[model samples]
Target: MSASLEKGIHALKEQVDSTVAAFFSSCVHCGMCADACLFYTETGEPERMPINKVEPLRRIWKSEYTLLGRIGKLFGLTKKVDDKLLTEWETLVYDSCTLCGRCSMVCPVGNDIALMIRKTREGMAVAGHAPEGLIGATTRAITIGSPMGVKLPALQAQIRHVEESTGKTIPVDVEGAEYMLLLSSMEIMNFPEFIEAVSKIFDRAGVSWTISTEAFEATNSGIQIGVSDLAAELVQRIVDAAEKLKVKTVISPECGHAYMAIRWEGPNLVGKPFSFKVRHILEVLNELREQGKLEISSRETQKLTYHDPCQISRRGGVINEPRSLLDMVADNFVEMPDTGKMNWCCGAGGGVSSNERADEIRLKVFQRKKEQLDAIKPDAIVSACSNCRLNLEDALEEYNMDIPLLSLTEMLADHLAD
Candidate 1:
């Protein structure tokens, strides 16, 4: 075996704990997950099935862990995972699957297929089978401390712009602040208005929050590329920065995977509980609204619908918070066919947006989102995740749909009550 393939098989072997064993054993091959997957639904290809995409992982479990398969291995009757298999499945694993957790939500036999895909990616990454886009992102995440290669100076410049526009001093490295806010590089580079929006909302609500110069990047490419060590290193940056600043909470901005990385998976990846708490910005904003601190001067009149980022809604358990926050600022809010936790992915999450090779397939599978929007026919769409917003914008332009895309935070900021 080639060294990379050997390392990948060993990595796959290491991932087969009791949970994985149960998940593999419990799968009934009922095709429920296939139907749940948007790639399969849009493309009508069996290879895109969520369960089939992780076939390599399942093979490893059977050949090494099961009694009958152990006998087959002894007789050289088992199918071995090789570099060829990894290369072939790289597209299926990395390019097609979005890790959106929708398949996990709809598994009839309760198989968490999306989780298994992630486990499969751990082996794929070790085998050097990850996509060029994701590999580049993971590398930049470790080396440059931002997947998009954003630097602290860029963030400082953006903060200065926001500060000057809002006439509110943007706090940085402020010790003992109630919250340390983190931003995705997309927001830093592509959507600086999100930073401005947060400033306006926090100023109006009198919330104690500061940006950390040491660790402000919210998104974790490590998690996307399935490198736990790299992911742990990235998470530790935020944990250390938060503890050093003695902040009460680390607020994950409008980035879905970032919230999942830092808030849901960070503690486990680091093998320890956090010294402080972590919450999504929506959760924090909803709390402030409930406390009567967040108010809107006027409600949005145009018809608006929410696009629930899969990580934030399904994976992160932040379903109702966005809707409740919208209630404060949108009088004509509408729901898509499958809103909230069950909403469809934007076809660009889970590092798919970063993978240029997957761009065509990404836009192709965007038909699912197009159908969702056609059902509601809203004047605009509101979403809490920047990654989703960018993807939605691109897809909307491709489909020649003129509907506007709005950030929920920016909307609230625009209507902040006096």
Candidate 2:
């Protein structure tokens, strides 16, 4: 019932569905996934390979789930997974890998390596192998309604400040609002300007948007920590709040993993399709632009480049929305070397930013991003995800780079027509 090695192995056995079986069976051992992974590419460690990271889970599946595995186990040919093996693998799973899905993108056999890693973390957590920081964050998310312990009063204070500064009212829990906005804790505590920017933009566009005091937090630490039960609980709050408010759509904030968790994973985690649709904020802004509701008075003449947050552009299928918005406002916008789906991760995704233990390795692997930035050498970097912005800013400071970070929504709001 409680977390233990037996429970972790049992959980691993349960995760071995047909897709996982096929993935493990179809691996060609070609090492293509290695080159695609930033961890492996950075350290050249064979153990950091995405496929290798899930080997413990794979061994369980081989021995317990498959007929051939069962036969092999009969002869004691299968390698047993133990605490020692898991202890050795904790660094590979938590510290090195960011679950960026680049390996999945380049898998020659179409294996969803990233998803497998997420599933593998379920077992890891059960075995008590998850990073201490992620465990604390998940605990806070369940107990305090936010990973960062941001409560409604904090949100209300921010809301009051934005209302006072902008001279606009921010609707909360308004029944039948056209769109419901969900924000990440990072947006609330670190980037309160994001709330103000969205408020001004929606007010100028004459849009009906309300914030939900009940389910305002968007980032799901449960998903990051790879626990479905906790993830579903988080998703249920959003579903309950959205259905109760009768909002037509819920707009995921400019945070990358938040968009992926709320927009893509929330429905499945909650075990049913949501009553309302979920959309990334960029998608809604683009819709408003197409509808001629969002108008810009002037363009920015700065030489800037867009940093595609892995979840926002690659995982969320929002590649063009931010680019279109940027093209409208930025006169000299340039693309990074791999600007779209193949763009490099900010190196702090998949809960790495929350885990203080990953600080050094995260900055070390950030060399790939550093190389990309050095090549373009833009005036500033613009991105949607607040998490990515924080990571990028940290890494920039680590490297002593002078480039600044900008948010797409904030930029669009700045150029709004009077």
Candidate 3:
């Protein structure tokens, strides 16, 4: 066996804990997960089924962890997990599966199919089978401290612009701030308006918040590419910065996976609890609203619907906060069928947007989102996650649909009482 293959096998072996063994053994081979997956639903491809994507992991578990399978392996009767198998599964594991957790939600036996897929990616990555795009992102995250390679100077430039335009000082590296804000690289690069919006709202609400120049980037490519050690390294940077500044809360910006990385997975990856608390921007905004700190002078008259970013809403337990915030600003708000935790994924989440090889498939599976919008026929779609917003914009443009996408934070900021 090649060195890479040996390492991959070893890694896969390590991933087969009691939970994985239980999940694999308890699976009823039900087709529920297949139907829950948009890639499978859109294309009717059997390989796109969520449970099937982890076939390599399942094989490893059986061959290594089961007595009957171990005997079969000794006789060369069991299927071996090799380079050929990993190569074939690269597309299934990375391109087709979004790690959105929708399949996990629908599993009859309560299996976390998404988690298995993520674990399977651990082996795939170590085996040198991860997509070129994800590999590039992981490298940039390690070397530049931002997956998109955003530097402190770029953020400083954006801060200068927001402050100059709005006449509000955007604090950075301020010690003892009540909250330390984090921004996804997408917000830093593709949507600086989010930063402007946060500045305006925080200023109006009298909220004490600061950004950290030391660890401003929120999205973790290490989590995306299934490198726990690297993911831990990235999370530790934020924890260290937060502790150093003595901030009470770290606000995860409107980036879904960033919130999941920092708020949900950060503690486990770092092997300790964070010194400061973590909250999604929506949760923070909602808290401000309940405190009567957010005074909205106007409301959206045009019909609006909210798209729940899979990570931020379904997986993160942040469903109601966005809806509450939207209610404050949108008079004509509507719900797409299966909204909130049960909502369909944007098809570009969980690093699918980063893989160029998945672009065609990504847009193709966007039919699921298109159908959701078509049912509601809203004039615009409001969402919190910047990555989801960008992907929605791309898919909407490709479909020749002229519906506009709006940021909930920006909407609240725009309607703040003058």
Candidate 2 residue runs with Cα over 4 Å from true position? 1-3
Tens-digit per-residue lDDT, 1-418, candidate 2: 3459888888788788999989998999999999988888877788889999998889998898889889999999999998988888887887877888888999999998988998889888888888999999999999999999999999999999999998889999999999999999999999999999899889988899999999999998888888888999999999999999999999999888788888888888888898899999999999989899889998989899999988888777999998888887899999989779899888899999999999988998898899999998999999999998999999999999999999999989888898
Model 3 C-alpha lDDT per residue in residues 272-326, reported as the tens digit of each score? 9888899999999999999999999988999999999999988899999988888
Candidate 1 — which residues are off by over 4 angstroms?
Answer: none
Candidate 3 weakest lDDT stretch, 10 residues: 322-331
Task: Tell me the number of clashing residue pairs for each predicted model.
Answer: 0, 0, 0
Provide the overall lDDT of each model, using Cα atoms, as 2-decimal numbers: 0.92, 0.90, 0.93
Candidate 1 TM-score over all chains jointly: 0.99
Rank by lDDT (best first): 3, 1, 2
Model 1 RMSD, rounded to 1 decimal: 0.8
Best by the lDDT measure: 3
Per-model TM against the reference = 0.99, 0.98, 0.98
- In angstroms, the error of model 1 at 354 is 0.6
